[model samples]
Target: KQAMDFYDRALKLASTIPELQFPLMTYLGKGNALVRVGRVDEAKRVLDEALAVAEGDSAYGYEAELLLQLGLIADQQKDTARALALLARATNLAQKAGGNRIVAEIALETGRIQRQASRPSEAESTLRAGIDVARHMAERLLLPRLLGDLADLQVSNSRYAEARALLEEASDLLEGLLTNASSPWVRSRIIDSMDGIFLARVRLEGAQGQNASRLFAVLEQARGRAMSELVSARDSSNPAELRAGERKIAALQLKLLRTTDRSARQRLLDEIFRAEEELAPAATESFIRTRASRRKPVTLPELQRQLRADEVFLEFALAEPHSYALIATNHSARIHRLAGRADIRKTITA
Candidate 1:
């Protein structure tokens, strides 16, 4: 709660700071602050006013974007119907405006909200539409992120082979772009884009833990107490809950990256561990219904052959309330549970 309080204060500060420099960015900050405080109608009115002034080919396009933002605000407020309705309107406007990029953006946003609402089939269709648009436009940057999002949805829906293909495509695209990027900013943006790709791979690893290869297998261990309970409650858990927990963990991890305060970082780490704890690693209904993907793990000799003499391979995985280390060498590989993430964090920050 203290960490959240600090986050709140930071948000308030950011909303007021005039040093943001860019006029559009400042306006967006104010608009977002209004939405956060339940002044949705007021925010909508402001967008409506802006739409009143926009002209020509850009008018409907801008209007579509504003509607998309409102749809996102509705989703945040848990008004799924309102959100989807707004997105539909935005999509129609974007299509009429004839901009493939805006069309793709609305599709992606709508799909994400749909996934959150647990309409997986609809979400998949919407995401696939966006992917098609992205491919048509030759949108190298946007396509990878869309692929990652759909990969995540596929994992949740227990389409492991589909998920694996999408993740591999995204990973390959991202790595290819990293080699092609000409500037530091471009490289950094590409790196930021890999977060979801890595996350989807992690989910795939966890879901296929029983038999899959460790290509992206960081690790998976449940909270000790929850293990027995998890098996008993296995059929009760849903894809929505798993996706929600992963989103929470991702948000906290992002916060951890931005924070410098020792105490606040620890709190965020603790929250991450606790959030992960609730997500015990038992298959959902989709997983139970679908056959898992199969792949061969890299042998110890193969892994060692790829590594330099000075480089030792170590993979850290957040196994719910606790953490673990998978250490590999030329001759062998082993995994052992370490202390909780908070303890490791404290030790590092000390």
Candidate 2:
């Protein structure tokens, strides 16, 4: 309410002065404030008014900023095509105005659009170009964001090692920046990116089974820290910090579930299922309950079917407890006797 009142006063003052620069800055400030408050539709409306005024006055520079804001708004609305078009126009206008910072920003946004559209090759190229330009111009603040975006593209493309290296560099840059500033936004972004790298590392390590125990331990420690941060964030005065903490908690939980063992996994899933059951009665009355579900029992023939379905699973599933455990647990005595006959047939064929 206070912000809207201030904006109204500033708008009136700008109208009275007519020659002052307050109108453009005031509109941008109010629009940003609206966005921060989750009033994105209102922000877009305010920015549209600002854009009309700037375009009518031939204020090319301010017009570019408004266009960039509009592109971001479209992105948030999931109108990727519109975001790409608006961002491209913003880039062209910024370049024409010799505004390299805005150009870099548009490039970054373009890269993000490409990434979201599953065009990682294009995203990598565009973001790399933007990062190069930002580096050449010594735009210290923009560099880390661009680098992080590029790393995300790498991760999307399954280039885990490369992504890890890129994220590490970004983390170093952000750490340095955070030391001299109190920006919860930047800190949160950095921590989230670092968490991604750690989770990726855990997945790779777990798959290899090399140092798996150590990797799982590290993941647990990270999860604990992330959850603590989330708890602390509830009381935090900074909204950005709270949001960041929540995101971190979600990511950590997903990573933890993906990395935990079968027995531990079943326990976690059971706990979650029970919690939902308890909450369901209080939240809504028509909830139906059933026995806990398990994976479909795999017979020897079913194993062959699964092998055909996923050839990659053959290498891991054919060996050890996974292969023998199911056969031992689920098969009847007749099926166990048939297994010996099948082995003899395979031996004769060999």
Candidate 3:
């Protein structure tokens, strides 16, 4: 609020002094403030006015900034199409103005928007190109952010190993940047990236069953750290920082809960339920029938062979069966041994 008030006063003074530069800058600043406060409509109006002035005076920087601000506002509203269009224009203007940093940032943001809209292939290419540009320009801040976004897309597409590598690099870069600064925002971002890496590792471990206990332990520790960070942010005066921390905390909590129980049987059941939910009512009957037939019981030897080959496939079998049969494969005819079967006995006077 105070910042906005000062910008408003400065705008008035700039008008009085008839300084074209200050008024344009002040209007852009005020528009950004309005957007931050969730007043998107008002922000658009203010930015449009700034754009008109910039166009009239041929102020390229101010025009590009206004376009970027409007793009951010559109992104906040989930209007990806408009956001991409505005950002494209801003990137072109920034390129023409030799603002490489702004161009890199806009490209990174556009890729993120594409990723959010489920365009992973496009997001991957766009973000990689942006990262290259950022790296060439030595845009350290934008580089790590773009890398993290790309890593997230990789994870979403089941490229776990690639995601892990990307996340590790992002975490390392973020940590190095944090070491020289006392910026809470930067530290929070680094922690968020580290948490993501740990969560991905946990998912991988859970699937493999190689270190389930260790994975859960790491998840619990990360959840605790995220919650503590949220508490610290809540104690701060910055609402935006607090909100970001709170969101991270919520996401960590939900993801931890979901990944902690990775039993194969449970996962299979969940998958079945999900499929049923997604299918139409008329189609569900056939789907269920097909699923049941697909889940037919296998013999003990077959089950053992499957479990030995792939642990992930173990959840599809019945935990307990009505009978147990031991078959010796070395015998000429495969002798079968059955246990727990009692024959009926009768005692008669004869």
RMSD after Cα superposition, model 2 = 19.3
Candidate 2 lDDT over 72-165, as tens digits, reads 8898889998988888888777877878888888888899788888878878888998998898887766777787777766655677677667
Worst lDDT 10-window in candidate 2: 285-294
lDDT score for residue 134 of model 3: 89
- Candidate 1 lDDT, tens digit per residue, 1-350? 45335545654575587674223333345556677677777667655554554433256777677787878878877899999999998898888888799889888888988987889999999999999999999888889989988998887778899999998899889878865655546756886787657656766665555432263232221222124324433544457877787788899999999999999999999998888677655223334332122234445456677887677787776533355556766555655556766788889999
Each candidate: what lDDT? 0.70, 0.63, 0.62
Q: Which is superior by TM-score, 1 or 2?
A: 1
Which one wins on lDDT? Answer: 1
Tell me each candidate's TM-score.
0.57, 0.53, 0.55
lDDT of 3 by residue, 1-350 (tens): 89878987887777777644546567777887887787879889988877887888776666777888889889899888999899888878887887778878887888978877888888898889888888899876777777777776775677767766776676577656644434456566666656545544444334333433343343444555556555554443434543454455555455546675668546655655554444335343332332222122334344345443223321110011111222222111121222222321112222
The collision pairs in model 2 are none
Worst 10 residues of 3 by lDDT: 314-323
Q: In angstroms, give how far residue 218 of model 3 lies from its true place.
A: 5.7
Model 1 has an lDDT value of 0.70
lDDT of model 1 at residue 327? 71
**Candidate 1 at 88: error in angstroms?**
0.9
